[model samples]
Target: MTFLHSFEPGGVERVALRLHEAWRAQGRDARLVMGRTAGAMKREWPDLNKGGLGYEILGSERIPSSGWETLWMIIHLPRAIRRIRPDVLFCAGNSYTIVAVMMRVLLGKACPPVVAKISNDLTRSDLPAPARPFYRLWLRIQGRMLDRLVGMAPPMRAEIGTLMGADNARIAVIDDPSLAEADIQRLAAARAEARAAPQAPGRRFIAIGRLAAQKNFGLLIDAFARMAGEHDRLAIIGEGAARRALEAQIERLGLADKVRLPGHVSPLDAELAAADALVLSSEYEGVPAVVAEALAAGLPVVATRCSVSMEDMLGGGRFGLLVPVGDAAALAGAMSDIAKLKFDETAARDQSRRFTVEIASHRYLALMEDLARA
Candidate 1:
């Protein structure tokens, strides 16, 4: 059983969904248990929303506060685990790790081996100075509580191991299961055709993620306003509380004509096919699934240096451009010079193949089977 907080359109949730689908496709009896049956994913993944895909909702209704919902899950997850009695409990991401710790404590001997994924950057640099200590303490607790920890890429092994004080024996490096084989093929085809055609100076730049403060859409807007050409346009896809603020920033910058906020676009093949490049202005991230997706689409990417794995993912700026975190001037400069940046589509796609669901699912199955036997 995999534990999730909700059906929210989040990177962690998206990865969990992909893994669950891949595992089921492999004929494993995988099940998803959520704190609540709410969020945009209900519309995006209707079958899962309808409970058609082995989905179990602890709460029938939405909770206004995600904090409170997490608390509710922590209180109730132990009972659900006892009833289901899954051979293993998969904590989908950092957000659900607290629930896993609580469930383990409550169930004691009955608790199954808990496998947790480090879904975000372990460095709490985004946190305020005072909160960093608490976040570090939580990491220490997670290291002690979780039976197994998974990192998305090889570079993350050191990051997780050092922060959590776990040896290589306890940590597993798995690829981020962000793309399917089909997704890679389809996007690569579209991108090849786009690259083959005569290109224009003005580029269509796309960014995908929730409109939350963490994404720093405001910073992206400010940078775009600085370097966007007359025909260039920027589209940010996804929805969240920061929608209104982002909309206002666009308006304030007088970029209403050049910028668009298309909420929660699915099957990004068409969008990626038509775009010239993808931009990511996040404050921090794990190995952002979108970066892998964009590479699979063979699109040049401009991203903030948000993760320790960023350099590795971008091949030290060989595959894509990486700017300092929160540097609008640097980002705008990179955006302005994007057309001059050299990119090898074939190499980019090859790099991205490592992140496909097929590879990740196989590794995950092997790990789970090993755990079951142990």
Candidate 2:
């Protein structure tokens, strides 16, 4: 049997890659067809030439295009599925979920079952006005066509089901299959090495993710500047169109020396392990992989209450501090509290274990098996 997987790069793509590897290891034929927008996947998984695995690119050359291009993704995707002709199709990421459901409806039973994994809570009425109609239509389509819908968190399951008008039984809550034991170990070693090396004694704060409006790193820099005297340094990883503007903000705040934008780095687990704390200033999120990784590494976290999952992930503020979105003062207060907060590595690791790749992979495999047999 063949399994076709689709996702754009970024955290979602990384999770999909792990699931693909797991499926391939199980002797199933798995092929990963990534959209051109998923540059991170193209860069990280260059070995797409291997047997039983294939990578097909779609969309425009620009990382994320606008207007007609985004809509055209729906047109191109169906053709791609017809070419692959797999027994089952697994779609990851929100964009891919919409696309997969459409394809399944168009292909009917000839296309095999389609499973769409949702990584975020979309039931909230906060979606941009212009996209709401299309978004609602897409969810309605998913309700009928999708064989199963997997959510990384329970809240997400409820949110997607409510929005799509789908049965609760059709939605399964599974942890994101990206945080593997080996990933944790590698991060631990990287942290140890960074500590043992002759690094400066400066207090470093690291934030990971694309430099987009949703990430809200601008607010993070402003908050960091308030504590500039206390913490010696700050770094925001990942890159996007907003990098230049963010750099300008750093300079305007006179924090050029204290702040650094390191672009994107691979194996961010090590970076999380080495940092004094992980600060998530996102305006929104699902179950952020970075937060889970930081918690696993025993790093204290300070994040905005962007989503219900954030509160759930942080153990209702027991694991870390939560600040209101866009409030620099609240963010500053949370950062100050981090200085006094102590984390138990064992407890943190235990919390993170709930989201391990193995557990998530098994859940996904079981769901797919059930769908295939049905």
How much lDDT does candidate 1 score? 0.85
Report the Cα lDDT for candidate 2. Answer: 0.74
* Per-prediction TM-score to the true structure, in the order listed: 0.94, 0.87
How does residue 53 of candidate 1 score in lDDT?
57
- Model 2: per-residue Cα lDDT over 166-217, one tens digit each: 8988888897766888777766677677778877676778899888888899
User: For each candidate, how many residue pairs have backbone atoms clashing (under 3 Å)?
Assistant: 0, 1
Cα-based RMSD of candidate 1: 2.1
Question: Distance from true position, residue 8, model 1, in Å?
Answer: 2.0
In model 1, state the lDDT of residue 1: 91
Which stretches in model 2 have alpha-carbon errors above 4 Å?
1-9, 37-40, 51-53, 57-73, 123-138, 196-202
